[model samples]
Target: MAQDFIAPSILSADFARLGEEVDQVLAAGADIVHFDVMDNHYVPNLTIGPLICEALRKHGVTAPIDVHLMVKPVDRIVPDFAAAGASYITFHPEASEHIDRTLQLIHNEGCKAGLVFNPATPLSHLDYVMDKVDMILLMSVNPGFGGQSFIPSALDKLREARARIDASGREIRLEIDGGVKADNIAEIKAAGADTFVSGSGIFGKGRAEDRNRYDTIIGEMRTALASVGR
Candidate 1:
């Protein structure tokens, strides 16, 4: 299995102090920075673009930036993100007119390519491009928003995706985004999600009260994951 990763979504972090929040989270044990890019047309919300990603690099954050592009016409923006320092760029299959081409474009730009599947989106999208994807992200909640509960049906979906990854005999990572908390991470891991993305669960209101807030939650999450024994 690929190594487990705890990717903290910066969507729930303080945008005013984004650089510090990212730095602190990494110091607190986060593996990758989950950057959520939302465009109002594809998803109801509008969010940060590549400039913010570039800013982070300038801010001296060297950890991998996992860029989840929730934008329509994803192909045009692929290279921009790669230039902005994105280590991994994932997009929903439905958003791209040519899924295979988009995957190729991302690779051509020198970033790890990935395909994201929403709760209702089918895994059939992975049928032809399994070899091209470096990671597979499963969205447990609807896109465009943060702080939603984990959808119960996603567990079965995770198992199905895991089977496909193992069958392919490739090193593709299986990532789960949305509603991942220390409480449920073990169960999610058991279902075969190695990369966990949590927004509100990690950067919730409790952060303001505790100086080592991220450490407390991330440590608890790691402890919970340890119980699963890889």
Candidate 2:
């Protein structure tokens, strides 16, 4: 597997100055702007939604906003984000009652769609939706929060998904979200993930002075990738 740079999570960005924060991230060489959308029913927490995505676009964020929908009945909300200019929308397979319809709906809306599986969700859950997705996000920590510890158990599922994609010979990307930082990045990438999500690890607990912490983490993660010849 090849290594890829971090997709820094923007959930920790200061909402008061979102545009400037996003610009700062881009200046730091972030590959994607990760958005965490949580509906109270599905994830016990409520955060931003499609409206925020629109704001990000309106504020001139050119990097793709990779929207992670931690909401149920994804079909109802996907189109809104699509209209808001999301480049990708990923929903957990467990959240949508009709996974196929949800995946197709996202695709029909013109944004790349992906299926996410929680740490306890098995890889076989993707058997039916594999061909319908552009990417797969395997959560390395429990949803509903940021900066949780990485679950080592999740790595096996990532490898299994990679094997399935390889056996099918499909060009799909494997992504890992939560608990991602410099120390474990290379090992996780070696396990077959090329896309990564980092929230506190990127924005550093919302203090501007601590922004360098995120920068340093990203730099070291890239250095590890380079060392591994990825």
Highest lDDT: which candidate?
A: 1
Instruction: Estimate candidate 1's RMSD in Å.
Output: 1.0
Model 2, global lDDT: 0.83
Report how far residue 114 has shifted in candidate 2, in Å. Answer: 0.6
Candidate 2 lDDT by residue in tens digits, 5-75: 47877777778877787787777668888999998888988999888889989988888889999998778
Clash pairs, candidate 1, are none
- In candidate 2, position 36 carries an lDDT of 91
| Regions of model 2 farther than 4 Å from truth | 1-3, 205-214
**Candidate 1 lDDT over residue span 107-212, tens digit each:** 9999999999999999999999999999999999999999999998999999999999999999999999988999999999999999999999998933677854
RMSD of each: 1.0, 1.8
What are the lDDT scores of the predictions, listed in order?
0.94, 0.83
